[model samples]
Target: MVAPPKPIPAPPPVKRAAALVAILGGALLLLWPAVLNGYPVIFSDTGAFISQTVVPLMIWDKPWIYGPFAWVFHQHVSLWFTIIAHALIVSHMVWLLGRVVGWGSPRRHVALCLALAALTALPWSVSIVMPDVLTPVAILGTALLAWGWPALSRAERAWLLVLTPIAVASHLSNLPVIFAVLVLALLLRAGWGVVMRAAVPLVGAIALLLVTNVVGHGRLSISPYGSTFLLARMIADGPAQRTIAALCPERGWYLCAFVGRLPDDADEFLWNQTSAMNRRPDGTAIFLGGREIAPEAREIVMETLRREPGTVVMLGLGNFLTQMTRSGLGDTTRRRDVGYGVIPHLRNGFPAAEEARFQSALQQRDELNAWALAVARVFPLVLILAAPFALLGWARAHAARDARALGLLLALLVGMTGNALAVGALSGPHPRYQARIAWFLPLAAVVFWRPRPGVIPAAAVPDPARSHTSPG
Candidate 1:
């Protein structure tokens, strides 16, 4: 007489403990930055972002998507929800990294995540209130979709779709990074045999951007400031100086009137209220036509480049290189002048009893900035080495049919390079821009990293059906 097979018993205590540590410890690590700050740290843009939820208005300098989201959390629950939600995303990446490595067991996965939490700057991404934290998350999600989609479960695929768009919509910079990865994914599909729908998330992000803009800014464009930003960078460099020197009297461009007053630093010109952009008593950007005629700014940029092509190339190269090497405080300008700027006015909108939450971070800005800089010095070198190591692993894999192995390396390189270009090119070199996602360089390399004989690669088990599938 036969009996139905008994259901398998649940995993034992040690295995359960390993899983719990992986999740809880990983979250605490992600939340470490907030813990250090005494509360979720606020950037200069925090008030503006929160405005979208409270005032529901669009900001010219930053995206509105994050504002409403954090606003909802700040109002309905607590601002801590913002930190909690962010930590969850980072923890998921730690889990996914473990899965990709094919670690021998749960304990191994826990070990890897703990190592990353302790060694990498990932917590900064999760701890900060800005959307900048999502940059690495987006790159990792895109790489997973492109390189390991076949091995992912159905639920995982759904989450990828959700995560990627949130990332792309979170910031204008993310769109370029995601798009570059998508293009790389297509190349892999065509040349390496990988199969996955890379464009769905991108399209979703673009659509979301348009919709959010329409709702907030009353427009369908990505942002009204692109041309202005580019123009600002060009003006900061030498080309705009030369162009103004030759054409100001003949062309009647407003910048000609204040050419001698311009600063050599581009960011200062764009961000500092006393800079040349405020040539007019009205406080409008004369070179940017008050930021209303972006096309005119674009024309000036092109004219400058046409006149001195080498300057554009050199400026871009310098900006990219500078950005790659540094990591500084996110909103130093706001911290320096918190006493009498827009903040006191903005504080009026804070939820009751939370008006003082950001003061601690403000007071300790110098100490924290120094702490970050010290930690940051090592990351650039680690990131710089990551690409070559990935190439080395691909070369050593010796498994020619393994498209997944090569695709991963390519995705990481393209994503990081794209981030550098989008941020440094359009916004100019600021260490904070590059630091947001540079850690991915070394982290991604670890995912596709190869181990020699007798040294088992630590990652998740490969699904039997996917073992023979080409990764491209």
Candidate 2:
């Protein structure tokens, strides 16, 4: 009764080879900074992750996923493999984005990757051996799952379904970022089919974390030490200090012993070995002792909220606003002196040969310090100036009926805001906290600037009224 449907043609071998070359080149581009440094970048938290992998023990604060991830790639041999994995994974995601936006050509993919490497903090995140790189990947993956599903090939869809959950499970903060994006999609009426499809990774991530925790610690929780972080945030922001001062004589909390002398910074309160929580009056250091008072910390946080709700809200809002504008590279790129920051952890986790290479790295020698500091000063200013223009571009894309671009823009906006709120409002605002994900802003801008017209696959463009059917 009808003619047979036409099958989609495949790329020729020459084009396929070219595309493969571009992906490989893009992966190398992502790793250029680390190559420049002569060693993979390390952060203060890098050692914690390394210890978790080498010793194969769980830390109270961070999730156990990244440690095993590192181990799987590195095989306890060298950290370079882990960083290389970061590059390859991100490059593949970039290529996937290109396909969704009707620019799946090798040349375009290479150009986009080059632009991102040069303009954004993405290279820095990739070079570093931390889970921070996964934040953007998870966010982007969720967007693709929600609105770009129809555009993706079956194999690509399967890859994201597997990769997204792993990315989400890599960090505690990522869970909230993914949830916020999904919620925003629903609020924008992305439809139940879209929301449910996007939510697959979120559910899988949650299940992975719960199952891992239950197996490791006999606890079915996301973060057993979460209360300590909340307490640290409250104390740093002044509400917990006020709460402790008022409730001490009545409640006799453990934190009362050093009421007036507590460090006013959340990081110091949580990680400074010299702080009262970590060091006793006898001067014996109990690094990260906040874990011991976690239950009490929860009580303190609840009481602080009950007593000073307005103050808490105001301070949290202040932190969130500050975090939104504080993206920079210095914190992640600066030199960490021996016996301090990441050095001790590296020394403890790796063999002498590895440590020798690390000691001679550009970061340890302070060779890139000035450049990093300069970037720290300029990058945030650039982002602040670029925000309104980015919004305008997104509006233009929406007006043009470019749902693929619109979906991506929305994902980056929501993910960045969620990251700020989750980290800044609760943990405290740090330049690195925002810098880790700020790359998405510039990446979003590129997508807006370069999208081709009338070339996006019809199936890829979401239908506003079609809420009943799900894309494969």
Candidate 3:
């Protein structure tokens, strides 16, 4: 008898088509919140990104990469294009992650996406025009490159190698988050080859940010205003205020004039016009009074850290804890006031028609508040209750010798904690900061889930007898 043709490694054409359909459905689901809102969500920073495309203006607070990223998608067209691009990116990352673990089937991938959309802040993150969506994208990308590299196809590896750096570069906090994840992965012995492979993007992201800063701001630093943000956080947390008071009469810092009157909130201290670091009397726009105060800000931050190490440590710990539990979607959906900084920028950069659409959007009308707030309140409790069961599933996956799956879970856990620390302790605790990456926890829970003996269809499991086999 003639030898049978060797079995094909790729999925059959019909199965591939089904997988494509499932992926498309997941992308649409991720876009559903914006669809419901009748327009893409816009944050105060959205305008700043838009303004970059209009002019070479460098806002002291954020990197310039996101401005070009937004321009590439929207290109002065409807902002919906930008949001859709984000949804597609996240959807594809999820599909790739599933393939690396045991949940490679289209059905499982879609189900997990649906659960993430419904139960977490992922949908809101994607729906918005902010760079927040990239937080999870970077995490997922890091996981795939670091632990799932062995199982990934050549094309998948290449795609992530290029995309992960862009995702990581889009935001300032992402660099530290990726660094923490990779360090932990190395400590856990995830494999030097793959972990170092992941580090390519992390290092590339840092290089990219620094190069851009050099070209844009004429500086070789990752963030020229990083000290200002830290100073704001310190001032808000109380340590900086005490330090300022003690050093003021001797040092004669500009802020010495407002000792007892410092705003307790970071935003108030930074944005409130009447407070310190006020905008010019001409009403010119600037980020917390721009880079002029960076030297002073750095001095305050260093002095505070030197004087009140214990108090700073305790406050940072408290903020991190608060951020860890503060995963809610409300901030992304909140109403955008007409007078908000984002509004004027939007009008200046976008066409009149696009601006009109934004003015009439449900978010501008504050119509999304009720439902968004309700979802924000209810889903966090669900996440807390599900944490134990998710841990159990992760332990089971580890027991089954699914190293890639287990490694991903550990990496993501570290990433989430790192994000909390970076934003909460270094900046200030905010729901949106934690909300952006919170969905990954639920995604990890799904990755750890194994099929019940008879509950899953035979077609869903590629091989029933070897369901627990490690993908790597």
Candidate 4:
């Protein structure tokens, strides 16, 4: 027999060096602005940092619910920190993707491209500070847990399982996404052993929350005072609703001038009345509480929805869309105000110019939203192009044969799609809501469509002799 062919050499140092440069270059490009800008480290940032640091330092009260953490910390923290955290999280996600797709593969390039696209497509998200930072990290972590399942040893999978709860606990919105990924993993037959291994951490987190709440708050939930406060507000503001109704139906065009500019108490009162009248006879409202609804406020919104389901649906859709497109570097202004200890004073002060500026910013945000919608409408085309190539790469890598990789692909598809639909349907298609899903779409495409190495190109496949030949 011919002398054993020399084993194909590994990638030369030059190639490896180039790959490292590309990866680092991509990461730096994505992160440079945040570093230069001082990273939003106050307000939301401070709040998140506090939640992560202080709450753990204190008793574990309130289960670390997203609500309590936000409520307590939002006031004290800076939006800058939120922005910085988000940037770092996104960078981490990129690094994770590089590892999963094989650092030097074309798929890795695709991941880089997708990550870059996400930065550009949702610049507001990348640059801002909010719970939104958790979006990519959660999505990527879930995907990695699924995709890398087969390749992972038992110990590794167990570690991922433990990490899942932390991922979910980081942001409430991540719950549905994580749940979706877990469900898909089950369907793909990742095996019960793997599933349980992943769930241990989540279970431990919940247990910890329960113990904390009992010790710190004397109740299971964080906002025990919220209901009582809400009731008091309703009592205080009850008459405002009746007044508005009496005035609006009875008053003339003068009402137009005073609609949104009404006093806070008046608005609260009317909102409550509207909510009360719309409740079911049994006294339960359509939507649940905990999202800033006073008793009266709930009644007001319920009444609107009941009276005009169609209108409510339309408006909800509009709001959702608007929310998705709007960006605030996670309450940056609020954080700065607090950081400077001017929040209390500013709240009492009435700056007409600032108000005007705010209104103008709102108008600009709406315009940007319109542009985002136009872009989103054509997003499917991009998916069509990128997905196939990624899939080709996956196939070349025998991705399906590897349970971990396969599971990840399935999880990402299902979780991302489910989240997109859920947000669109329940919340309405806001770009911000979509932003969470949007950021992951390109990565999915890259993971599925990037080309593999060491495989014969399609062009050579039909020629058996040529196919057998190695790349020189």
Candidate 5:
């Protein structure tokens, strides 16, 4: 007798579509400057790149002297690379996320919800030129590699192992996220063996960096160690000086006058004074001196706290409260100065006067203070509403056999909370510092999000009786 026709295995879900959405979204954002005028809004590391690296690369052929990557020195070339890289990274993240949540199955609704949560709520995260842009991509990628280790072909796993370090190097914020991932990996039954496998690439990268520094600079330091030397001076100055310099423009002017008169680089002198007081004295200043200030400040604040611990506690509480309420959208405070750098190159493409006008607008606070307050007040409520769904998603992922899902959830929780507390405590609870953790919050939300009632699980068996009979 002829055997009954066998059932065909279903195709792996079309996770690539989600990636396309991210790519298209990122592409649209790159074109935003045409319409938006002051597209990036703030003058920060992004502007630093545009001026110091990108502009120079376009004009001169000499080896670019900024950041670890020399390739980013040219403006046009860097812009093209940025757009393409952003698209690829964003798309890859979306695609991986779709696969994680089973996008093509009944759980597709959940997947879509997760994607929307990531994209819309944290608008700055999706478009901005900060290190946080890479956070989601790195965290998600790490989580996937950790989760699918067994199921992945040997080649795929090896490729992932190689990519993890490169992902970590993409941004400093990623280091904490990576650490969290490593912790979760350990917790998920990936012992030292798996860790050693992952470490090979990271170690190699470190060695390469060291070799490059020694060969290029005749020293073992990376990136000139400029910030590190400045930080040493800041730590010696004392907190009061640092605080005054940071808060009081008059004090900054005084510092500039004092340092400017000295027979040294005015910038270096000012940086030295700031670092000696505000930062730690450690030879290596990690996180750009953020890690040192909190504990030191806490010790200094201890006497005040001892006298009024309740009041101090209340202030700490207020910090968290204030952070929850703030509006994270738009860069209103920092001015974007174009002519301050290479104005000649862009003179043909953009009018100098018009660029100045754009710079002026960037410096202004576009949103009213009252508007920011109102937004801040309602922000926590939105988070509260989203929390339950997110928790459900986390629970579902937690129940999976793969450790990476659990690791992702854990990393999301720890990184978001840790960064929040660290920034809140150290930086005296500024909304902008809290904004650094903004991308993480939404990621955590998506990882833990649950579908509304009626949505089915992705991999359900057809027959209830047969499913009941199957081994656990």
Candidate 6:
């Protein structure tokens, strides 16, 4: 959806017989590492997802859906199911984007989809076991639905409608990212109908996440560390210290004692595992302790902002800019291990002896790592540089009009910025957080690209909501 699916006319795009082969080739490439491993690749967080799934104990950091989904596979000893399912889901979304713009002959569409796979680290997110991949899914789904809904076929519309919410529901961070996208749409002048349709799933996802958390945790909670993470971000940004200094011995913030000991980076404070937050021996954060500290975290953020408003604003803007260019492949995990991350924590029924047997079967991803590293590093920066031009191009393409192309570009811009704020501004600003949504910049560029020499108005000008149909 980042690309406004414009029409492709001349130079026959797809050859009938070659289409399927091209698509299959891309799918294989997307899942190449998973295939080599003999099982799905695992991340440090993958264990949390597996634990919550099998134990039925709600882990605040993990969403309710992922755990159950992971559990079913773990129970059946079909962990590869996670990687394959993620692959097919993302593959279809990539395919749908190709169809939306009405690209080329059959061969071109296939080639375009394959080309997209190569040009971005989008697929690598799916190849690993983490929720970051879904951020793109929600972004693309909402963009396509809003921009090309009129031209989309019923199946295409339904595909996006179905997948969008699931993607949103997959991770807590996605909620704010998608919400920012919707708000940006309105700011950019997208119609009320467009916003409402997009909101349906966005709203549904929020509700689902809550209910799922209630079911999993037996009590209602949105992510367990919202305020704490925010507090961490404020601290990292260098303002929470003001609040901490003022509230020390008199307040029971627990954190007050270690005020000077805080790390310069938020990730060091929140994720170092040995941070004061991790009181338990089992590697789990002390839940009750976190609860006691959580309320103060919110207060610290607000009070600090009051004490130093300009600093907070500057930090936020810096984070947003940093987010625009920090994407990189394999940023989420250490990027090794077949299923060992999941093995040690397998609810006692599984034995530690089996860990060695499941270690990644084949260990060479030299080619993938090399290519993705470049895509991750260069693509986001290029997109950011090209964003203003892309937006201006969209506007210039019109005669006192702005439509889907601009909407798609704006959505990508806002979504990436918002995600950076949600995930990075608070707690920490990691390249991985930005990487999740960074690659979409290039896709949007391609989707709403400038037309050839004298192509008059660009394809499919903006339209009213009622008049739209998913492209056939």
Query: Which pairs of residues have clashing backbones in candidate 2?
Result: none
| Residue 399 lDDT (model 1) | 63
Tell me the tens digit of each residue's lDDT in model 5 across 1-472. 6553232222233432333344444344433322243433333444443443434331111112223232342233323334344434454444344444444232443354344433433433433444444445555556555543443333334445555555455443345445655665566667665565444434544555455546654557433333322222222223333433444454332223223123223223323434432333343333433223334433333434444456545554565566545525434333332224333433433345534644444233343333333434544555666567667767876565434455556656665554454334333344544454454455556544542333222322111122232111
For all predicted structures, in order, the TM-scores are 0.81, 0.90, 0.89, 0.53, 0.57, 0.78
Give the candidate number with the greatest lDDT: 2
**Ranking of all predicted structures according to lDDT, beginning with the best and ending with the worst:** 2, 3, 1, 6, 4, 5
The digit string of per-residue lDDT tens for model 6 on 1-472 reads: 2554444332122332343344444456677655645545566677777667555456655677666654544463556656666665565555555445444234544555455556566666666777777788788788777775765544456666766887788887888888887887688677776888778768878778778767665656666547777787887777887778887868767677677767667756666657755554355576545455677777787889889889888888788767655666544433452334466565343445334434533332323344444555655456566566656656654533546556666677677778888765554566667766766666555555553332222222111122232111
lDDT of each: 0.64, 0.78, 0.77, 0.44, 0.42, 0.62
- Candidate 3 lDDT by residue in tens digits, 425-450: 88788888998987777777667656
Residue-wise C-alpha lDDT for candidate 2, range 1-472, written one tens digit per residue: 5553232234455655566677778888888888888889888778778888666668878888898887787776678989988987788777767677776667777887887777677888898999989888899898988888767655566778888998999988888889998897788787776889779889999999999888877889888778999999988888899889988867978778887888789988887778877888788877558677888888999998999899999998899999887787746666752235455555666666787878788888888667666545556665766677778768887888776677778888899999998888988888777888897776666666556787564222112123211111
Stretches of model 6 off by over 4 angstroms after superposition? 1-25, 36-39, 69-75, 218-221, 280-292, 330-341, 346-357, 361-402, 450-472
lDDT of 4 by residue, 141-244 (tens): 66665454443334334444554555565544455566666676677677765575445434544565555556755667533323323332322333333333
TM-score for predicted model 4 compared with the true structure: 0.53
Q: How many Å off is the CA of 427 in candidate 6?
A: 3.7
Clashes of each: 9, 0, 0, 45, 17, 19
Task: Using TM-score, give the best candidate's number.
Answer: 2
lDDT of 1: 0.64
Off by over 4 Å in 5: 1-42, 51-84, 101-121, 150-164, 170-173, 197-218, 222-380, 399-402, 421-437, 450-472
List where candidate 4 sits over 4 angstroms from the true fold.
1-25, 32-85, 101-123, 149-163, 198-201, 208-212, 221-402, 421-429, 450-472
